[model samples]
Target: MNKSYDLIAVSPHPDDAEIGCGGTLALLSEMGYRIAIVDLTNGEPTPFNDNPQVRIDESLKAANILGIERVTLDLPNRELLDNIEARMKLAKVFRKMRPKIVIGMQGMTPKASPDHYQSQLIFDASVFYSRLSKWEHLFDGMKPWRIHHIFYYYTARELFTQAQPMQFTINISKHFETKKKALLAYESQFRAHPSYNPPIIEWIEGMGRYFGSLVGCAYAEIFYGSTILELNLFKQILG
Candidate 1:
């Protein structure tokens, strides 16, 4: 079944999307938007998680909570690189999904994991490469696809010290609990981590509330745009 998506979020690891934009995803899903998440890595080789399959299972559970499809690539965790090969692999998925909006990681996190930055670069290139018609041979005969919009989500490990101002925010006050439940699906990473501190769910909710406060909402998720977004009417801004 070749399914199309309205939005596709590219995650650096299995749980990155759930941590970064689960609330917005949940709200979008409720609005009847078809959304998918492509995980660049399986997020294995962690201190507590021994079975890679278990992580895949957990990601599926989380995806179900958000009501979106999830795809995991074979890119190695902690060693993601933004190279031609990686970009081509991702381009194939972009062509297949043909999403209108593509969401990815913010590229300027110098203190966070290198995989975060590399994933950003890979997505930036892959989105562009997906529109190149001459890459048919390299991309398994997938047709060219040009996405309309690209946005970046903030990760849990991300520090706000160097945060870029969000261009827009989604009010997820109604779906905030659903986001927490989706994140809790990754018990191996958050619940069982040997050095787990600052309980993850609480922190996620706090951040959501803080961002919501900026927009005068109860809970919200922030996004950084790659280009200026077009507004059709004044009511859109009023909301």
Candidate 2:
């Protein structure tokens, strides 16, 4: 069993983590890579679950669907700030997960909530914090995690299109539906919500198909990276 991971998806909110790399996570999981998804918040300001407890419950249910390690920072919606306390909490998780690759939102917004930017900041901080020697407490016996690569996943496609140097894209057509199913686990955010006037499923599929077309597929997930991408000498290609 290949328990070691090559990549990890980081998100500030419940759905953000899954949406950005759910298909890739699933595909990689099938291929035996250990994948971890971090959910920084409980998806607060949520219109559906009037009670705070219910939203937390829903988030956990959704995490179970993804099938890997997960964490909830429980940060308030639209009020996240970059601070030492918050960074340390995230850093600890990074030390434990110890992934080789990291990806998260670029904090792009049109009519976006503060959560969008906060989420991105968390990813950036975690990526760097994990490598710092100053943070000796995050890991057992001060073992630092040095990630090899980092990428920014576009936050809101309806508003922002990052012209970042494109490294590669995951053709999600084959398992895009699997990703959607995992998303559907967040029933509270969609069906359970009072103002879910527009079901999330429709938007997810629309974006999936839209992006998938970019790489000659029925559905695909896109990612932009700073470092160059290299196909392993023995890499098994995926459709």
Candidate 3:
């Protein structure tokens, strides 16, 4: 029997999903939604860390912190590309897991890892490829599954913002601390290590606060989607 998920987040690496949408994931899981994060790579061989298992362990810890499942693929870390192999691997997951919603990382990070941009391309393709009819042989004969909704999360690594057609923020006031704790679980990446020593936690908090202020909340996370969003305007405005 195949496993199922209500939502699956595609991350270029372990910490991306945590940094981008941990609060939202936590809130949704609390609401009894089946959510998971799929890391495209182990995110190893960085300046500070050489051990891949450490990163893997950190990712699992973060997943536990946010009450979500995690899956790490065997793709290359820094050398990730939007090729057939990568697309098929992710599409296969979409087929097997059968998520109704898929959230992916958006934007190109020139200063950061190029894998982010490649991840975006790969994610877009996998969503399409996952629903193809005659790709049974490539995906080990798994049935094609069409995801119902698509959303994009930002890493906040870019210096400038790219205007998206459908952008919105979710109130994460109650779950902001959960998101912070999850990101802190990635000690190898955020802590004062050999080389990577940035005020990531502080930065993330600031970003969350800024976005929250725009929506009159204590904390919030931003997301982009192509699908039209339908909501009760009066309830939102009065709340």
Candidate 4:
């Protein structure tokens, strides 16, 4: 039997999850969740961050900093939509990973990038596809995989907020610094340009603190989910 993962973070852009949910991922991984990451794009042809191979290297660096096994689709930089072809390709990943939980990046909708839109499609599709009684080929008959939960992390600042309605607010103060360290691994992206980069890691820490303040912690990782989280008798949200 495949060892089920406790959480999976899906990111459309290179630094997105690192910015948005890095604290959560770090905390979960530390809590012994078999965390996995899927990056849909390779960060190529970017105006300031070009270089395909270089981008992949930097992504791997960031993943290593988080100690995550990242699966990059290596799709085109700014385009990752779904048609028969993209869905079919993603189906292959769903077949292989068999994640028990999935998370995706959120969007402002109609005002998001094609990559973000496609990532959302992939999120919903993969969640459904994993649980189907009959998927279209590539595997044996009646291979069904149901994920226990789905989360969409903030990416589109317009719709999601630094102080938005959150499904679950996890305290990741201990791991916030860890997340910052991992984000710094992607130096070529955030530390590369003159006018582009924000103090990526510090900025994320500040966001964490803001969310943490909402829940009486020094840091928190906000999450939006599809289903009501299962809370144990201890009142901690069950993984």
> Candidate 2's residue-wise lDDT over 1-239, tens digit each?
12445677777777776777788777777777777777677677666567766766766666566566666776666787667666767776777777788888775665756667766777777778888885575455546778888987654445565567754678877677778877777776766653654656777788778887776788877778877767673555442
Q: What Cα-based lDDT does every candidate model obtain?
A: 0.86, 0.70, 0.90, 0.71
> Can you tell me which runs of candidate 3 are displaced by over 4 Å?
232-239
Q: How well does candidate 2 match the true structure in TM-score terms? A: 0.85
Question: Model 2 misses residue 102 by how many Å?
Answer: 1.3
Which residue pairs collide, candidate 3? none
lDDT digits (tens) for residues 1-239 of candidate 4: 25566677888777678777887787777777788778877767676755677777887887777777788876665667766556655555665677777788876445446677677787778676666665646445436667777778875344533233447777888887778887777767777874675655566767788889998999887778667655573755453
What's the CA error at residue 118 for candidate 1, in Å? 0.4
RMSD of candidate 4 to true structure, Å: 3.6
Better of 3 and 4 by lDDT: 3
Look at candidate 1 and give me any clashing residue pairs.
none
lDDT of 1 by residue, 85-143 (tens): 88988988999989999999775556656888889899999999999988788877888
**Which digits, one per residue and each the tens of the lDDT, describe model 3 over residues 1-239?**
26689999999999999888999999999999999999999999787777889989989999999999988999999999999999999999999999999999998898999999899899999999999998799889998999879999977866345678898998999999999999888888898472455778888999999999998998999999977868797997899
Give the poorly placed runs of model 2, Cα more than 4 Å off: 1-5, 137-141, 155-157, 193-195, 230-239
Provide the TM-score for each candidate, comma-separated.
Answer: 0.92, 0.85, 0.95, 0.85
Clashes of each: 0, 2, 0, 0
